[model samples]
Target: MSNNLALNIEKIKKEKSGIDVLADIYFHAVFGEKISPENLERFKWYGIYAQDEQQNYFSIKIPLNMGELNLIQLKTLSLISKQFSDDSLIFSNEQKIEFKNIKIFDLPKIFKLLQEVNLNTFFEAGHTVRRVLTCPVNGIDKTQLIDVEPLANKLNETFIGNKKFENLPNKLQIAISGYEEGCDVQFTPDVSFNAIKDSKEKILFNVKILGNSIGFISPSQVLKTAIAIANIYKDFGERDDVEKSSFEYLVKNLGLIRFYDILNSTINYKIQQSSFKNEISHPRKPRLGINESKIEGQSYIGCKIYDRVVQSSKLDNLSSLLEKYEANRVKLTHKGNIIILDVPTLNAQNLACELEKISFNPFV
Candidate 1:
């Protein structure tokens, strides 16, 4: 470990209370900075804490809204990597980054980097769209309703620029997937949409509200058609409290009738109940299997990313491999998985073997 990290750990242990030692240590390690006593007190208001293990290792539980550590911040993280253990920068399941191993002396430098880099631009408060994750495969799926990427981008742009939406009391999440197999795990979001085939064979988007993560997991009947539903949440969503600021809470507080009334008024599209048979299913379940996509003849393999935090260099290397191997296309699944498509079937086994060498095991 770097002397900077060692000194940071010791200083945190000495100066901060048991609950704050982790955040103070992490802030220094990653940004080379420290939180003031007052800010630390504020963090406590959110129930964040520092935890220590038998190995004397410590970590901080960060909220989800703090998701925007950009490319510049990532470059700065390279400095942290050099000065600390490789495991020091850990990404949580919710996509939050945790920095381990920091020193008090490094605090000023970390603060300088935070200020210089303006890291606050990336941080979101409660129930904002910061945690609204999506699969790159959203619109490209062979079976999907209207392309949702445009809508998703619009939501992101609106949230980032619209100060009116920022001070909501809580965080909100939204997910859209066009596949029936539920590959994108849309149900896990605060508000979710899944594309389904209607009786007429036309594709219609099903809106699921308060589906998961805030107490309600029941797959409600399609709340409204896709475009209208999106507009509804975009216009009338609540952010009253970060903890209770999910679509579920909104639906609970204002019954679906009133909610749809608000939604119908805001959107131009008709609010029609979906004619499709609603398959009550969990969204996060895996859709791919040996029988799903015929892979016996393909050279390239699909690899499931545990979290979407692979290094940029690794992505570049994968691209290079695709070019070298003449793999012409890459597919991103809603499940946060990547598919390197279109390789000679004869070479598939060899390619899979090579990928496993890099810790990417094909789903057998």
Candidate 2:
């Protein structure tokens, strides 16, 4: 695909840009309201990607921060799948919920539905800072001293919908975790932070900027540190070659020292010594089958669907099944799996069976 995006994306905030035109399409579909060719390419802002095989249909991606979804949101998403798309909800490696074969006409309704249920596809895709991923067991993990959810949410709330950060030179993938055992340090596209403690047990974060050397900052500083780096990326990232415009490229071109100088001007970003290290060496652990929750008598079920594809027809059934068993909270994993949280231990087997009935194989 050619990179004509920089010119077109600027219109996203204007009247008829992809996202801005959604309301018009929603209201005028009966009168043949159609997206212009220019807006067609801009639809990714709303997580709507044009299907390669079908021009009129799209594939939708939903952002679930920290891989979480309540019972209501699941019902809304699954129902949209059954009503619109091919009943195929694809689980992305980043833990997002996706539905393919969605009609161009249905984008508005879907967006509206998600808003009603307190869920959204906004900023899930495109050149924006994608979904904020965090430790799945953030609150429940006994080994975790601090909950990364607050910090992750703070970063998300700071950037999403804010015009300064809305249009980035490239997408930024951020991951935060309090647990060092299974963290997403290596794969995060832009930046990552692992919550840690010094010898005095004071909370701080080990920061990885543009995937380079380690740095340190207080728990309250992740927001400022992130903004500074992102601004540097915005001001200097390679926009001409689209392909070379990644954070990695910026780091390679300017070198870490220059990047640090630019970053220091934005916040009191602390650069740790060469010997400082973070302990998160392994990948994120799978929260599958039946795992003990922090609360006794309740467990989180990690069920694997053959691959990440959850058919539209199965979603409604699965949603109902989860609600029936009183396990309404679901979390998607980086491994492309789903975890049913807060299930009663006694109903774990029954829930697993129901999931299998819908072809979401729990045994795997």
Candidate 3:
């Protein structure tokens, strides 16, 4: 493990991409083989981590794309938690679901279960793109300037197993928002795309890297711009010090202009220098309680998971209500609240009461 890469983790990533560890993981999980120290670190790539010093128990984190799940997916997660994870599901602020205290031999079964639901832990913890975050009400928010969910989904899909982004100096996080007031403006991620209107009254995305607004891009250019920035960070980001390895640190050291120049070379279009109207400077209101959706006769119910833990039993109970109300999708907000989407306006109150019965405070 000797190389020019300063951090041991960097060297490991250089030697072997974390995505290639699946076979080894399968073997270890099925045969109960002992994991070597290097592989233990590599396990982070799959969102698997040793839960104890002895490595007898493990924890797994499942990234929810845009924090979204259909009713069937939610039911499957509940079944997994109830049968295997001590009847608990820990919802993270990063909008991931975690199951803790799992025995080693159960890993195979858990992974299989997740696969059935089209979920994976790849890059969930390692020096790769973490789960892409987005506005919870992207498609349904009344005040949204554009629906960034499709772009977010496409951006996430483009990078998931792409080798160019596999071995970065540090983990990367990206958030996309179309909220008129800019939902992710205050949050810090390696990159963010906030929807805004141009002087010509056309919609464009205000691109920020490490909390600084680098420029603007048309919706059609977001994917390419993101790829270019990712490449810049992969090639030039500082690796000598773990503390300085994040893309944020690199942006600060290189300054925006130099970074923008590097970015321009990697993409087809010239980057546009622009400023965003800081709407967040005014008082911000939280999206809570039953609210009207963009679609007529439809409503969305937002409930505060205040403590952010949902028992498996509650999800089991919720499955019935989901079917009863014909609400098929649930969204987890960046603030840790949960929103049940696509509820009929007529059924919103009854559904809210049902959510309250399970300790999901819809009043919030």
Model 1 C-alpha lDDT versus the unseen true structure = 0.45
* Best-first order by TM-score: 3, 2, 1
* Runs with alpha carbons beyond 4 Å of true place in candidate 2: 1-34, 52-54, 181-186, 269-280
- What digit string (tens of lDDT, one per residue) describes model 1 on residues 70-141? 334555544553454243344444434445544444444544564575532222332234434544434333
User: For candidate 1, what is the TM-score?
Assistant: 0.55
What 10-residue stretch in candidate 2 is worst by lDDT? 271-280
**Evaluated with lDDT, which candidate comes out highest?**
3
Compared with the true structure, all predictions reach lDDT values of: 0.45, 0.71, 0.80
In angstroms, give how far residue 328 of model 3 lies from its true place.
Answer: 1.0
> Which number leads on TM-score?
3
Candidate with the larger lDDT of 2 and 3:
3
- lDDT string for model 3 (1-364, tens) is 5543235777677667787898888888778878877788888888999888788889999888888888888988998888788998888877788899888788888888888989878778777877677878878878888888789889988888677787888888887778534564236778878788877989988887765677888899999888877888888988768889988788879987888888888888877885533223331234789999998999998888866677887888888898999889988777777888899999999999988978888985
